[model samples]
Target chain A: MDYQRKYEKSENKNIKKISIIKYIICVIIIPTVIFIGTKLFDGKKYAFLTAVVVLLSCVPFIISFEKGKNSTEKMVILAVMIALSVFGRYCFSMIPHFKPITAITVITGIYMGGEMGFLCGALAAVLSNFIFGQGPWTPFQMLAWGMTGLIAGLLSRYLKKYMVALAAYGAVSGIIYSMIMDIWSAMWQDGVFNIKRYVACIISGIPTTATYIVSNIIFLLILARPVGRKLERVKLKADIIEKD
Target chain B: MNDKMKIFNTYHPLGLFIYFASAIVITMFMINPVMLTIAIISGIAFVLTLTDIRTFLKNLAYEIPFFILIALTNPLFSHNGVTPLFFLNGNAVTLEAVLYGLDMGIMILGVIYWCKCYSIIVDSEKFIYLFGKAIPKLSLVLSMALKFVPVFKRQYRKISDAQKCFGYYATDSYFDKIRNALRVFSCLITWSLESSIDTSVAMKAKGYGLKGRTHFHNFRFHIRDLFLIAVTLFMDIVVFTGIGTDIIDFRFYPKITQINLNAESIAVYGAFIILMFMPAFLEIKEKIKWKYYVERI
Candidate 1:
């Protein structure tokens, strides 16, 4: 019995040690896997698979949380967050504006944080594609957009005028998103990642990029003052609610 | 095992993984349209089985406006394809292009519906359980964001009802409705921002970004999970093979490929739908458990 107990304890310790090592490997390998996987496919299908892989690869990292949360509350929060993320993505297609995606993602990131930003960006692409149409590129769209949100969230800590930063990021990522998407398209459809095609894709996206920039600047310019002020007021109220 | 499901239910997680896998494999392998259609329909049917037929229809109803817009706009912008149907102000409208648009429209609607099924069944906690460890900051953000929605929704409802009480009639025209929507959205944004700051502060106080942050999750590897992983992996291989071999060739243009409409597609779709409704199935099972408990008393 004593021998068995010792063996079990040692095994548990070994598992813990391995898990940390696995996480470190994951951090390094994840982006590489996504880059390669995306390069292998094209369009919406490629995008969809990339997103799935990214989500799956993160599994080991998610398993390390401590237990005993308010289960119902936690579940409810998760549902709402996902819905928001999905809806955020959906609205990007439906809402007619150049900067709708960037504006929403940045604002959401500032308020919600990086993970939600990732979900929002990734899901918005996937969900919006349902309206635009799903194809081999859906996952890539998710990743491109999700990365925007994730970056915005990371930057929010440093930027006081979060909206302006968001607009700038949005404009840059808008171009980046199309460029990356085009590279994926070149790979899948042509079976070769063509620089000419990549350039052509980016050139084609100029109108959309311009629209995005204008929209982001205008949206942030208008929204930042009133919205930021109101948010400050609400924070005071939430503080009371939390204390109670 | 078949009882009212708590958050710990494995079925939903299994289904989530399946959804991810299928979405990946289907796109990667270039599965036939016939099979894709089968997968889409089966997913819907599975959702119907879990929720009421009426509820399913109602949920679909919400997507109609968006669907129409996508269908209409695609053709206006994309003037490609052969076999022009007519000339609208010297612009050609081709049969092939319209069909292409329709195909895209259907695909889009199908994906949205599938995602809805995924969201309804899995929820945030399960998603967090699956993703929280590797990306703890991201997980917390997602959890907080999810928690924030209904609070905003409830507050919006209260505010709108109050407006109605004061004779602020909300409906007049589409533009008016839009105006009201903007108002509500701005308010919601305000609320979210405030709460976000508070949440961030709270998290920081709790040592959120301290070195070596830890997570606690309770996931067990049971026979069922193994079964799911094995089955999905096998199906993925088969689906890819079907695509690679042109056994289920689905064409988008002038040429159309036929599928056998037989066992393989049907079975794959059947399993897909079941995976979607695993959450609802667990819920129903829970109700049955409560009923059995009362009966025993």
Candidate 2:
């Protein structure tokens, strides 16, 4: 029994070490390499490189989620959350650029673990875009929303304590999403990255960005309390996710 | 209903997936006039064949303003190139910028059309099959979420109706209506998350995530798929080599240089045209085969 316990302890340490390495490579190394590649490479390659780098940044979170020994209930709950966001999109379709998706994603991240939060936000992009339309911008949307959820989950403890911080984070994420998408527009326009054109795109996109910020803040303030409580209740009742 | 799908979609999912991925990516990289024209033309042709004429025209009509917006916006912001077309708000709207803007717009159009074709060809089922073997868990999550979208939407309607019956939405005040709408939303989260336990149990009972899990899918990798993939990859390599080697140059900055096509560029250009029109070639061949059989009949 002692031997088995020691073996398990070493194996757990190894797993933790591997995950840290994965994060370093995925989050830090790959992006740095892509940044260098973008500089060295000629005009249009950066467009493809950006797409690849953003997609690769998303892979670690997804791979870790898949690798974890998770329950089916978590998957089902994630499905439900994603569905709720998509339904939210339908509810507010009349309004342009204003969506409750970011707020809902953050709330889920607060309740669920970071990985499930990332999955919810990312899958919500894919699932909803399947109905709307998939474009070159889809990958960027996934990255933006996924990071929102991942960061929200990481900062859940702090955000859950203060509603103002949660709303602030939502507003910031909206800006990030809008900026990331603007990078795509600039790249698309110039076929090369031009600072002047990118700035123009940002300026043109201000109205949309403002709408995103306003909608995210409103939705976060309203939905956080009810959704977070419900998630806590649901997670607690799910048995496998119950904390001591 | 039977003819709702196109000939391109009948191939294995892997081939179709690779085709669209490479096609879309390469089209985005291309700024050469010849290549972009081929891409845009074939894209329109593919979309036309994908859907009916009226729908295609309607989509194109809707896209024109956006296309023009993308085109004209470049001159406003970008004052590149030597030849000044006009002065707009003290910014010299150069010919290069206008042309570059139009190029960007065409490139964007090609991508959008390809995406439209991709959405038509690659349904959720095919998406599940494509990723299911490689990334089972994520695919399962995607599948589950896709399935739940409609179910949740239905339940939302049901709950909203019940609330309406209770005179929840009868209030004239906008704030009250908003509050009541949120309550319905809260009620949705509760009911769905609570029932997810049973859903998960039912799935667990069916051996989900178990070892030796058999996945049922309609796609089968055939020799034709192998041929399609090989051709697609081969063309993509040629296009990449041409682009990487800086052979097919079409620059629209400072001075719009008249492109002098070398032997390599011509070869690459021919390859891209063939690459873009493969679906058209296949559809025509199918039509010819049907004609021959019908005549014999």
Interface RMSD of each: 8.1, 1.4
Could you tell me the C-alpha RMSD of candidate 1 in Å? Answer: 10.4
Residue A138 local lDDT, model 2: 78
Model 2, B250-290: lDDT tens per residue? 78888997874778989998999889999978876776887
Query: Cα lDDT for residue B53, model 2?
Result: 86
Instruction: Give the per-residue Cα lDDT of candidate 1 at B117.
Output: 54
**Pairs in steric clash, model 2:** none
TM-score of each: 0.53, 0.91
TM-score of chain A of 2: 0.86
Off by over 4 Å in 1: A1-219, A222-244, B1-15, B23-31, B59-105, B149-221, B252-254, B257-297
Off by over 4 Å in 2: A1-14, A17-24, A27-36, A242-244, B1-4, B87-91, B171-180, B261-263, B284-297
Residue-wise C-alpha lDDT for candidate 2, range A64-167, written one tens digit per residue: 66665568988888888888888888777657876788888888888786777788888899888888888877778898898889889899889999988988
